[model samples]
Target: MSFSPAAAHPRYDALLAEWCDLLRRCQEPGADGAPAPDPEPYGRDLLGRWGESQRKYHTLDHLQAVLDRATELTAYAADPDTVALAAWFHDAVYRPDRSENEERSAHLAERALPEAGVGAGRTAEVARLVRLTVTHDPAGDDHDGEVLCDADLAVLAGDPAAYAAYAAAVRAEYGFVPDDAFRTGRAAVLRQLLDLPALFRTPYGKEQWERTARRNLTTELELLTA
Candidate 1:
């Protein structure tokens, strides 16, 4: 809830605090006035998944960044808290080698949220937003989708050094692929992103992030092709 939550992650107390805040916003108060259900267990479970040994780019640090970005863009969302829920579950089932991570992550949210006190509509919304990450292309009027998509992709607009680190981390994640194959695949992905009319849909993202992200993606693409 605070501005300093930028560093709030699984290893720190702030992440747990942040999750509880999100839970409170989406879940109705317990029968009468009792406190909302505890959200820490689910948060902890997801944190453990993020901290898995195979991860390099899709780690707890990435989750923290997405959550932080979603917080920054909260004003653009029709339901900011619901977007945050999506952030937590977006990579909950990440496995660099897997093709269905998004679907699996969405399923995890669908099964877990209702039991965690989130209403059906919000639960489905969270799952839908998680699935959206597969493309990161939200419709023009989809404010909540825009927020979550932009937040997940904000890393692309980072400073050169940060972008370099992100690129390196990604290569590390797909280490199993042969060098030539990885380069070709990576270049294609970059080209697809470059082909988009705009890499970011949110106004702030379009204005503040678009140019830099395009530059970064182009640079990466060239490197891969070269």
Candidate 2:
């Protein structure tokens, strides 16, 4: 299940529709009276909220990147819904101060997924995937978590120009700071990324993105320092 960036949006919209239909099918008649809101509008609302957040370097594009990679990786794997749901909600609450972004995002998804027709067990799996993105650490790993983390970091392993664009977009999202602060902070992030044992933890990630990601990081680090 390889995805072209052009076609991914429609594919995702169709998936959202199916998820909404599942909710409607499982609903008790008149439970909420009128009728369920249209899934397109509801999905748009979620995406819009994500877009408008001031602290969004990890915006819809970022989510899409993860989903695209997850789709490719999961082609040879299983439980695609867990990866899909995680991609949608992993960055739902995007505050910079808290280190618990993943936990909060997972909580938001846990509440939202049940309302959107996901089962309790699957919701837990989605939450697990969300947590996986918090740190690229792969020890004591689950297969799904590894896939999700690799997908999240795939941006770093993209083509150099695209990777640089992503790096700039990330800095722009946090552009309230002074130039010096942004430079220092951005440099630190690249250094930390360089310090990683491997940017893509899973074999699929390694195969597809490991080299490109390292190239992007090293190039950016040199540019940032000089």
Candidate 3:
């Protein structure tokens, strides 16, 4: 399929146009624009620099998955602009070697938004929300962040069959690992997910993601143990 902003998200067609215009203006040299970088190039560069496993984890498909969920939860979001920005930049810079990939991604967003005329304060808030994806902790005041994180993780809570396919895809991305080590690590990760109080924290996420997530976790865990 062609990568049309209209095709992937009909609802955001207008918003996509607006965003593109904004990006293009920013791209213009010395046109009173603050010289903002093209986010698409940033996305491309990040993916291009990634190792195999990180590439799969931070793939365009994963971004699309999170963006889809973020769109669904946007109706209930009070500050959807912040949520959407967080969704776009949350995984902007992913480095598997470091535990601070979220922090770095947030930093990139912080730097990029101000140049694009998004106020510094609002940019910081969005960056905070992007960082919050790492913790995936739900708080009364952080409903939007929770929803975004849940959406980011929805693949884990998706249908068992699909989740199994995702797991295999992930394993393939990490094909360097031995079969026994991969099975052990994968099972451990699934168990950790099963141990969480709830797969999705926000009301919307809980309603939409809990069952499938649990099913996926359980199936994987059983397969690992057996």
TM-score of each: 0.92, 0.78, 0.75
What is the Cα-based lDDT of residue 185 in candidate 3? 81
Error of 1 at 105 (Å): 0.4
Off by over 4 Å in 1: 1-11, 29-36
Instruction: Arrange candidates, best lDDT first.
Output: 1, 2, 3
- For model 3, name the residue pairs that clash: 157-213
Give the runs in model 3 whose Cα sits over 4 Å from its true position: 1-54
Give a tens-digit lDDT track for model 3, residues 1-226. 2343323433344444444553453333435655555545444333333322356556656666777788788776777667766777788787544669889988888887776556666778888888888767657667777778777888877665778778877776677778898889878777777787887877877887788788777877887788
lDDT agreement of model 1 with the native: 0.88
Write candidate 2's Cα lDDT for 96-162 as tens digits: 6556988998888788766755567888888888887767775635777777777788888767678
Off by over 4 Å in 2: 1-42, 53-56, 96-99
Prediction RMSDs, each to the true structure: 4.5, 6.1, 5.6
Query: Which candidate should be chosen as best, given lDDT against the real structure?
Result: 1
- For TM-score, candidate 1 versus 3, the one ahead is 1
**Model 1 agreement with the true structure over 15-107: per-residue lDDT tens digits:** 767887778678876567777678877766777677777889998889889998999998899988889999999999988888999999999
TM-score, candidate number 1 = 0.92
Best by TM-score: 1
